[model samples]
Target: MIEVQCQCHGRLNELLPPSRRHRPFTHRLKQVMSLQQLLIPLRVPHPEVDLALINGDSVPLSRNIRNGDRIHLYPDTGDLDDPSLVLLRARPLQRPRFILDVHLGRLARRLRLLGLDTWYRNHMDDRPIIRLARLQGRTILTRDRGLLQQPEVTHGYYMRATSPDRQLHEFLARFEPWPWLNPFSRCSRCNGLIERLPESEVRRRVPPRLYLEFRDFFRCSCCDQIYWQGSHYERLRRYIDRLGV
Candidate 1:
């Protein structure tokens, strides 16, 4: 049998038995076990935890636990009001671009509509999302707390709000990406810049009535999707106004 101690922060102590709060708690285990197994009985949601340290050394959840091992677990820094843990080193980009996870497609579209250079993929796997964020120096916007816990993810924001409109407002209030807003300058379907195209160039693609009605048109260089001012534009404009943009 071996003794283990838990040093938890803030309300995390509530997760422990009443007698263990502000005190060293001991547990006995037979032979050896993995950190994952040890934590299973604690009932702490694994996704909310970001890092675990064993005797001052970082270790993975799958690491084996031995006799007399002391484990310290930490929740995501974003959950804590600690400033020291909040500001990590900025990535290479002067302005942070974003890659939205599968659950945040609506927020991604709203961000792109504001021309914030957001990348969105409904089917992006965790591995590729992390890789893209690292390679492109992009910040990850995800609702899954576990994904933000990855070590490779240096810049990430865990979305707090579930509603798409509230999520956009939350991000804006948190990051203040106002300087990056370009407004209707990007493809809502794709994160590509729209380029001006003469009416004559896309005349065949539009209805004759539309050609006579609207003089301005923009085309996406990446997906070749066309954009023109119409009812959708007015709806989006109203949304932007409601967003206080």
Candidate 2:
């Protein structure tokens, strides 16, 4: 018999059934079982686990379980200085880029608003998404558990929050952005670079009275969309500031 208990933190608690969260349970192992085999069957994926202790000693996922072993699992952020305790995840991209699966179109745009290079297409098939993820070294953000389970998926996260706003918090916590991010540097609609255009050049793109009120203008490099510092700009600035960059 193997007794297991899980700590309440990270996505692990969210992944469990409401009835069983933070509860200890026992499973009988007729034969020896590795930690991976045990947890996967319980629907707790590897990325969801930070530390696995068997009989109060930390052990790797590959360590096999003998009968009567006690397990304590934690969603700990392993010590960055200690390699052994680190959670297994793909090395974050040297240059951060993300490929959002079909599920996260809104999040895709928000990431771009933060000047992060985020690629998204609505209802895109998984094969190409996976292919691009591997080919481009892009991190995959999705709500699909099965998508993260793909054998070739080297970098992926199972988004737990449903709303777009909360999802951004999860992303910041996950990747801890490496690149210097300047908000409003990218097109929110098309993922293009945004640059200032001469007021003369943007004349036709803007309404006369509105343009008179807001003299500054910017355009997207790819989509040629125009942007100005409007009331919405303040809201976006406040949103980004709330996210801490």
Candidate 3:
């Protein structure tokens, strides 16, 4: 049997039961286990995105817990830059791109509306989401804490809110993606860049009344979808304004 002192910090502590927050809890283990496994019993969600320290030395989750060990877990704030601090995940993304899970389609579209590079599909499974995140250097966003626990997902977040708007607020607060927000700059439907198209070029694509009333038009480079400052623009503008962009 082994006895260890475990403590959680920052948002990670929020995942623990109320009794465990802001306090070091004694964890008794009957058998040896990795740091990742230790989190299971502690109810720490999204362990892969968290940093672990043993005796004040940064360590990976794969490190085995020893008897009398003192373990500290922290959220990956991306600001810990001392040479003594070892990063548990890849370097922080300066300009983050995103790949959301199937459950986050609404959030994905909302992110696209803000001109963020958000890749999402209703049919995407967990494997492909992780694969795409790895191959394209996109951050994974999802409500599934289980998916964030996967070892391959180095840059991922578990969304805590249930509603899309609340989730967006939660994400903005956590990731602070405000600097990259360029509203109405991407195709929310296809995750494509929206480019200004000559009115003459898109004249036939839109309705006659729309072409006559709207002077400016945009088109998605990937999906060829046409956009314009139509009647819907006012409502969408109001919506975007509420997003605090």
Candidate 4:
């Protein structure tokens, strides 16, 4: 048998054996076991953790277990500037597009409303979500720490805020989408370009009073949805103005 010691984070003690809490905990595992297999009995989700150290040396999750291995694990980044111990899973994008997880549906709508290219599906399974993020070169925005930990996920972020407004502000501050914001140019419902539609053509699409009063209109090229500058336009304009860019 091989003996290993784990250094766990506060509040994560419950996931470990009682004797291991608040101190170095020891466990016995058979020889020739991988680090991933050794972590299974700990009950903590190992995949979400970004770095793991064994005897003060960085090792991959696939590293083999041996006698007297001292292991340490750390959560994902709370700040961007930190020492690198593990290989980063995701690559940064040149012009980032987002694929939001099931939980952040409201934030997805707000992103689309702000003219950002965001893809959202409320029922996407975890495997496909990770696959899509990698295949399409899109960033994964999720509240699920487990999903972010998947080795297949190359670029991902955990949403720190719960409220939709705060979440939007946090994302905007982190990614600075100001230069990319193209207000009213994207379809808020489908993420497609909004095409200019003459009032004469879309007259029946709008209220008869609006057709007579206003001459400017736009239509979604993908969904055939019609739009006009009504009170909602001014309201949205004011909201964007408050975003400070």
Query: What lDDT score belongs to each candidate, Candidate 1 first?
Result: 0.76, 0.77, 0.83, 0.77
Weakest lDDT window of 10 consecutive positions for candidate 3: 42-51
Question: What clash pairs does model 4 have?
Answer: 90-154
User: Who is ahead in lDDT, 1 or 4?
Assistant: 4
Task: Give each model a TM-score.
Answer: 0.68, 0.76, 0.89, 0.70
- Encode model 1's per-residue lDDT on 22-42: one tens digit a residue: 565777776577775676566
Worst 10 residues of 2 by lDDT: 1-10
> Which order, best to worst by lDDT?
3, 2, 4, 1
TM-score order of candidates, best first? 3, 2, 4, 1
Q: Which of the two, 1 or 3, has more lDDT?
A: 3
Off by over 4 Å in 1: 1-93
lDDT of 3 by residue, 127-160 (tens): 9999998898899988777787776777887777
True-structure lDDT of candidate 2: 0.77
TM-score of predicted structure 3: 0.89
* Candidate 3 runs further than 4 Å off: 43-50, 76-81
Cα lDDT tens digits, model 2, 34-136, are 8867766566666556677677677877788776677777766555466556354555567888899888999998999999988898968888998998898
User: Which is the winner by lDDT between candidate 1 and candidate 2?
Assistant: 2
